[model samples]
Target: MPSIHKNIFTIAVVAFLFRLLMFFFVFEHSERTIRPDTPSYVRPAINMTEGHGFSGNEHPPFFPSAIRTPIYPVFIAFFYTVFERDVLIIAFVQIFIDTLTAVLIYIWGRRLFSESAARLGGLIYSLSVEQAVHAVFILTESLFTLFFLWAIIAVSCYREHCRLRWLVSGGILIGIAILIRPIALFFPLIGLLFIWMASPNMRWQFMRHGIIFLLIIAGIVVPWVIRNYLTLGLLKVSSISSYNLLFYNAASLSTDLHRISQAQARAAINDQVTKELTALGWKGDELHSAQLYTAWSRKILFSAPIRYVYIHLKNDINCFLPDVTDFLELIGATQGGKETLSVLNQHGLIAAVNHYFDDNIWLLWAVFPFIALLGVTYLGTILGISIQILQKHWDSLRLLFLPAAYLTLLPGAAATPRFRVPAMPYICLLAGIGIAKSIQCYKIRQQQRTPI
Candidate 1:
C-alpha cells in the first residue's frame, strides 16, 4: 500500500510538470494573449483594486467576482499597489491557480477513491491539453472549475460524515461559486438530494436538514441578490438565463445557410431582438447589445421547437465527433467553428488540428465510452447502495440525480468538449469503479487458474 501510494504521488508530480511545460511551450505560443472574456474580468479587477465596487458594466458582478476568487487578483492588486500594474502577473497567477486545481483534483480523488484511481484522475486532468490550453487564457473556466470541484469535495465529505458544519461550509463555498458562475445554483438542489440520501429513515430529520442547508445557501447568496437589486433596480435571480436564451436562440440560427448569407437581414432581425428583451425586462445598454447581437437566435427556437430540438440533437452528436472544422468550413458549413476555434485556426491546419487534439482527446476516445459505461456503473452502484437503504429510496438517490441532471442538461444546449470538464470528476469516479471491478474479476480468474 505504501509503495502504491508513492507511485501515485510520483504520477501526480510528473503530470503536473508535464502540464506546466505544455503551458510554457505549446500553449504559450498558440493561445490568445487575451481571452474572449478577459476584458470583462480584468477591467473589473483593476477597478476593484482602484476602490470601485465589483461592477464591470459589461457583465454582471459574478464574472468580476471570479477574478477576486482564488485570491489571484488580490495578490496581483497588492503587487500593483507596491510597484506598478502588470496584467501578466495576474495571468501567471491564474496559471498557478490552474495547477493548484489539478492538485485539488488529486486530493479529492484520493479521498473518494483509491490512491491509484486518484493518481489516474490527476494524471488525466493534469495532462489534459484542453485544460492546459484554457489555463493560458484569462478565462473564468479554470477558476470556476477549481471552486466547483472544491464544493463537490466539501459536500462529499459532508455526505460521508453527516456533519452540519461541513454541510454549511459546502453551502457557503457553493454560494460563492454561484456568484462566480451563476450556473452553480444547481448545487444547492444537489445538496438537498444529498441530505435526503444521508438521512433516509428520519423523514422529518431529512427535511429539517435540507431546509437548514438551503437557508444557509440563501444566506450566502442573498447579499449578491441585494447588490443586483440595488444596482439594476430589478430582482434578477441569475444574470445568465437571459444571456443563455439569447445565445442559444442566435447560435441555433447559424444552422441555416440562407440566414447565414444575409448579414444585413440578420442585423435588422437582431434589432428586433433587443426590443423583445427590453419588453421581457432585460435592462442596461450591455444587456441590450448582447440581446441585439443574438436576436436572430430566437427565430430558430420560436419558429419550430421540434426542429430546433432535432438540430440540437445533431449538434450534440457532432460535438463528440473527431472531424476537423476546416473540412466543414471548406464546404461552406456555418455551424463548425465559433470565435475561439476561428482564432485558433487562423494560423493554419496544423495549429487548428493541434488545438482540436489538445482540447478533445477525451472526446475522441475516453468520454463517449465512459459516458456509455457511466449509465451502467452509476445505476449499478446506486441500486446496490440503495438496496441497503430501501426504506429511504427517494432520499438515497435524489441528491445524485439533481446535480447530475443539471450537469447533463447544460451540455445539450451548448455541446462542446470543454463544456463537459466540470462533470469529468464524477465520470472519473464511475470509470475508476468500473476499472476496479474489471481488475477484481481478473484477479478471481487468476486465482482459479492456480493448480491444486
Candidate 2:
C-alpha cells in the first residue's frame, strides 16, 4: 500500500483506540454509575427484539408511534439480540463506524479534490475530537454519520460513473439515512438541483436520471409514510419534525425577544403553542401536537420575515460553536449513566467548553486547535463554494448537501457542537483544498521574488 493509504489505516486505528480509551476513562469516569434515565431509543429496540413490532411501547409507551422512524432503534435491537446490551461493545461498534466515516471522507476528497486534500480531510476527520466524542454515545449521530457519508460517497460515484444503478444506490442510502434521522427526509431533493446543473443542456438526460433517483427514494420512504398514515392517520414519515420546528421557532422568538430569561414568558409561549395544538386534534398527543405546532411556527416565521432572516443567520453562525456543557452531560449520560439537561440554563457554548478545560494546558492545546480549525473551515467552505459557483465549476457542487444539511438541521431548539459534527467532513474538505491552494500561491509568489 502507498504511504497515504497506510496513514489512513493508522488514523482509523488510532481513532478506534482513542475512542475506546475515552469511553473507559474520561467518558465513564472510570466506574459505572446507575443510569438516571432511559433514552427513547432503548424501548423500541427492546420491543423489536422481544417481538413488539418496531413499537416505542416503553417509557410512556405509545402504540404505533409516528413520533420517530424505526431504523436506529432497530439497529440497537439487532445488536442487543447478539450481545445483550454491552455498552462497551456498542462503543466498539461506534469506533468502527466513526473510522469508516473518516475513510469515506478520504475517498470523497480524492474523488472530488486533490490527493493531498483527501489525505488532509481524512486525517482531520479521523482525529476529530468532536466526532469521536459522540461515538461512545448510544445516540443516532454515529450510525447516522456512517450512512450519511456513504450516501455522499455513493452519490459521488454516480456522478463519476453516470450509472443509473449508482444513482439508485445513492437514493437508497439516503432513504436509510432518513430512517435513522428523519431530518434527512428532504436531503434527497438536493439531487434535483445537482442533476439539472450538471447537465443543463441535456435536460432529458438529467430529468430521466433524476426521476429514477427520486422514484427509488420514494420507494424506500413511501412505506414508512404509509405506516405512519395507517397508524397515526397522518400522511408523514414522522411527527418529530413539527416538534423540531416548534422548538426552533420558540427558541428563536425567546432569544429575539429576550424572553428565555423570563420564566413566565417561556411557559406562556409553550403553553399557548400546546393549546393551539390541542385545538387541532392533538388531544394531548405529542406527535399530533408537533405537527400542529409546526404550522404555528411557519405562520410565525412568515409573519416576521426580517426577523426570520436574522434568526436563521444567527443560528447558522452558532452552528460552529457547539455546547460543551450539554456535550459533557451527554458524555455523563453515555459513560457515567447520568442524564440531565440542567446545564443548558447556564451560558454560551464557547464559554462552557473553555470552563471545562480551565487551566488544563494539555487539553487546551488539543482543543484550541480543533476550535480554530472549525472556525477557519466554516469560513473557508463558505468562501470556497461561493467561488466555485461564481466560476461555474460544477464538479464538486454536490457537496453543497453538507451546508444544506447543516442549514436544514439548524432550525431546531438551539445549535450545538454536536449538530455541526455531521457537516464537518465536508468543511474539512473545502478547508483542505483552501490550504493547498494557499500554499501553491505562496510558492508562486516566492518564486517571483527570487533575485536573479
lDDT of 2 at 375: 65
Compose the digit string of candidate 2's lDDT tens values, residues 275-341: 7766766666655676677777787667777776776665555556633433344345322112112
Q: Model 2, poorest ten-residue lDDT window?
A: 334-343
Clashing pairs in 1: 193-399, 249-297, 250-297
Model 1, runs deviating above 4 Å? 1-8, 26-33, 57-84, 237-240, 253-271, 274-303, 309-405, 411-413, 440-452
Measured against the true structure, the TM-scores of the candidates, in listed sequence, are 0.69, 0.83
Number of the top-ranking candidate, with TM-score as the measure: 2
Pairs that clash in candidate 2 = 322-416, 322-417
Model 2 lDDT, full chain set: 0.66
